[model samples]
Target: MKKTSILNKLRSSGLRPTKQRVEIAKLLFNRDKTFHFTVESLGKHLAKKTTTKFALATIYNTVHAFKKAGHLSEVHLRGKNNTTYFDTNISNHHHFYDSETSELIDINDNEIKFDKIPKAPNGKTIKNLEVIINLKN
Candidate 1:
């Protein structure tokens, strides 16, 4: 991502384009593909690849901020650790989680069909639906 575009995105997301945020955005949006990452793993990558150093708390804050801005999505799967994985793809979709390998594969939006949706409570509307299918070999 170019500097101008990154700055614009930060501004649009109501985030101040700080040095650390810029670097983090570059690390995130530089590629065309989507991915999932944890705060610890992202911090390690930044430490090895970039000259700039960011604290773990900084990474957490940036991740949450991006999620709030709709640039990232939270993924949940069945696991003992229950570690969090933030996905770069914010589009509507489902996931297939492999319990053996701990891999998450995106199920396209058209792949699944919802025959029936339970009615929401009064005065509330359904915002989104998340389906995670567990798989094992």
Candidate 2:
């Protein structure tokens, strides 16, 4: 993504376009498709790809901020160890989680069918329903 576009995104999200943030956005949004990732992995990725080193905390902060601003979506891996994953594609979709490979593949919304949805507790409504299908192979 161009600098101007990235800057505009940041501004629209109520975030200041700092040098570090711009670089991060460039790496993230410039890609053809947005993939799922964690802050730890993203930190490691930046370490290898860019000369500008960002603190691990900074990456975590920025990622959370982006998610809050609707630039990303968060998926929780359910298993022995639950890990939080972020997806750049914010559109409604499901995911196929390969536990062995630790890879997340996108599944279109219509692919999954729900026979029934339970009612939410009183005074509250289910905001969003997402499914993370775990795969062995």
Model 2 misplaced regions, further than 4 Å: 79-82
Per-residue C-alpha lDDT of model 2 across residues 23-132, encoded as one tens digit per residue: 77877777888678887778777878888979888888888888888888888665345667889989989898888878899998999889999999999999888888
Local accuracy by lDDT, each model = 0.83, 0.82
Which digits, one per residue and each the tens of the lDDT, describe model 1 over residues 1-137? 68887787677678898888899888887888778777877898899888997988888988888888888888865454577888888899889888787678888889999899899999999988889998878
User: How much RMSD separates candidate 1 from the native structure?
Assistant: 2.0
Name model 1 segments beyond 4 Å from true: 76-79, 121-124
TM-score of 2: 0.87
TM-score of each prediction: 0.85, 0.87
Q: Which ten residues in a row are the worst by lDDT in model 2?
A: 75-84
The number of the candidate with the highest lDDT is: 1
